[model samples]
Target: MKKFLKVMLVCVMVLFAFTLVFGTSKKDEKEGIVIGFSNASVSNSWRVFMVANYEHEVTLHPEIAASYYTDADDKPEKQIADVDDLLVKGIDVLIISPAVQDAVNPAVEKAFDMGIPVIVFDRKVTTDKYTTFIETSNYEMGKAQGEWLAKELNGKGKIVAFSGVAGSGPAEDRWKGAQDAFSKYPGIEILGQQYTDWSPPKAKGVMEAFIQQFSQIDGIWADSGLMSWPALEALKEAGRPLVPSTGEQLNAYAKFVVKNNLRGFIYPFPAWMSRIAVQYAIKAAQGEKLPKYIEIPVDPIGPDEIADYVQMDKSDFWWVGDDQMPEEFLPSFD
Candidate 1:
């Protein structure tokens, strides 16, 4: 009788384990959550990384369905329409990186009113309507740039500053943070400041004009990495020495630093933006509350920090983890 009782207990445990495995099977469940992602554009490297990371999370969870919309070319109208389209699908959650803060408000507010949870990543809209905002500390990044520039120049040089797309929060905060840190040095002269509208073409024109206007331009600071690439080209074409510029365009700018044009660089927290947004959305969907402001940490792209970013000495892009590539493989993002 005792032996029979032991056999019965073993059978009971086996049955319970089978039940657990069957209950957790996603193929058997069709009523899982759907998430909608609306992006400004994936034309740039950083945005591509953001989209890839989000897609990775969706891929790992077969129970979740994701719909993606890209407002090609950073057009606000396109973004708004895209968001409306996603809303019509009745997504359980919405993820957005606005084309620009103020212009994308109506669509964001619409999603909030519908009782859909909204997660803002990287770029932000100006309303508390978003359930959470996950992005880098832009102000701190600018301050690091300021300190680096001051040290590079020995606390004295004439600087020409490039502003990107005026009134955007990141651009404005970067500018303010840099100014606040650099103002401590009285010898640093800011010859001029102007907006590039965050375009390479505009930056080219701005750089040419700066060179024409100021002969003694010793240092330059850019608020946009997208802007700096063209500016760097213009400087090379005009036979002017390149100075270190700060911006989120760290990948392209890092090549210049490695080759010696940029004395210091600031890398934006874009790739991390995706991991964070995915984690936040997953938590919120599971009934967890998040912080109102989720500021991501970032490091200035100094030579010393290169190893932490690249991980592999041979690897090319910061987004590509060392684990993704075999150690023997060549590391070239190109």
Candidate 2:
């Protein structure tokens, strides 16, 4: 009887030890380094490419055991709620492209206060509570475009500007930068400036109005291909000659420039920034120290080199700057 009791006690002890070890291991496995991505919206081709790039990048890191994703549909309230929900899910890291600058501040600050590393990219929040900000300078992008246009016109022209969504950080910064450049030349006259909300249709309508308002438009300045391409189409429909313009590194814009033999400047705002953002998230999750700001470099594609960036075989919605993604992962509207 004594031997049996001793054996039973030893069995219970071993069982308890096994349960403790395996239970902790299971919990760790279930909770391993979860990442949350809160995107602003996928309303446009560029945003669609960005989300796709992020999804593909996550697959490359085996250590990233799980991920949560949310799209706010360009709504500030929805983005705030999405961030809150991600926090409740116990995510170790949060990556966000904000819908607007000031509206998402509280949610971002909360995540930072709770010790969850926050990474902001693409767009920005007003606060500096994020672990890192990854972006190519929108201001510089606009300034470069403006400077090119100014020089092309010999520091003078009757030009109209098309900006992206109003109140957006990118739009405001780019507009300001372009304005600063234009201010340097007294001969330059800005006929008008309108916000396109980054929609091709809206840009077309605005350009049509500009065409009617101004009898002579020497140059065109647009913040992105989303607007620039449609604006050009408006000019074509109106039976006006193509003018020197500035646009982004979109395949459609490049193709258009090549087909029309248009003189233009193409500065790429790469969608692959999301891929870099994911890499930073992984590093932050591993408790690595990172710089507070990471600015991806931008290079302008001149008329001489625009043909090199054109992918005639690709769909009109494709962005040329997203070469970092595999061809299979690239977004195509066709």
Candidate 3:
């Protein structure tokens, strides 16, 4: 009886060891990749949505192991330090959503030098040192927005443009694009162009000042969805003609598009492609290879198509109905 009991105990131990090895191997397979993520601070709604998007869809995948850093409030220096730290950790891939355009270039170049794959989302650096830049064509988007404005105004209007955060690539490109498009229309005149700092509050103040100065302001283009909302709010406060506008990723703008059927396009522009960043980082972690430029396309979301494509957010197309993610995929922030 004693020998039989001992044999039974040995059999149980053997089974336990087998189970442990199997579990470990499965875990190892799941944990095969690692990524380093550096993000700008989420002080505003746009960034908030971006961070939340990362947490929900990308990070939740077991195959993707991610180390994240935040440069709160768009601080360039902090972001650079975070990238260096990620490099020190030997992360397979580097993902950056810059706080500012040019300020974040050195860190990107450093990543390039280190032989790690780099993916920049949302905004672009002045230099082409990184691998795979996934950004919307801000210039072309601006051009389209400007063209829409000109046609809507019947080629004649006193327009005040709200240029978002100075020196940022989008700011320069979109502004140039808008101006370029407007230049084609001989009748439409841009009376004032103000630096909005991409802050809604600042844009509101600028809008107020523009309202007080310009007797008849017909068209105002705020490049960002956030800035656009504040501009409209200021115009409403001043009782301006509830003019048409454009934006990206702003729900309020979408609601307005639905309510008034505004003339606008949606740029699911990877404006800080928190999701794509995770994807590329994951690819690096999985040891899969990619190219230096994963150029993404920018789509125009006309107001009429909002209701139809509100669900089923196809990843290839960035925006749906002025909001970034499809309404179907919007995870609860709660």
The candidate that wins on TM-score is 2
Mind giving the per-residue lDDT tens digits that candidate 3 earns over 1-334? 2243234334433433443344345445555444666776554555545654655454356664444444535678888888888787666778787767899899999998888888887777878888777766788878888887888788888788887777777778889999999999888888888887667778889889988988888877768766776777787778777777767756656655555555655555553356767777777656677676666676667656654444432321123332445554342322
Please count the clashing residue pairs in each candidate, in the order shown: 0, 0, 3
TM-score, per-candidate, Cα-based:
0.78, 0.90, 0.78
Worst 10 residues of 2 by lDDT: 1-10
Candidate 1 C-alpha lDDT tens digits along 1-334: 2243234334433433443344335323545566677877654445544555655455556445444444434788888898888777667788888777788889899998888889988776887898998878767766777777777788999888887656566677778888997899888899888877666567789889988988877776777566665777787889888776665544555555555535556566566466678777777777688888898665456655543443334322334331232332212243
Provide the lowest-lDDT 10-residue window in model 3. Answer: 313-322
lDDT of 2 by residue, 168-262 (tens): 78888888889999999999999999998888889899999999999999989999988888888889899987888998977788888899999
Q: List the residue pairs that clash in candidate 3.
A: 122-272, 132-292, 268-319
Ranking by lDDT: 2, 3, 1
Each prediction's Cα lDDT score?
Answer: 0.66, 0.83, 0.67
To one decimal, what is the Cα RMSD in angstroms of model 1 from the true structure?
A: 13.3
Candidate 3 TM-score over all chains jointly? 0.78
RMSD of each: 13.3, 13.3, 12.6
Clashing pairs in 1: none
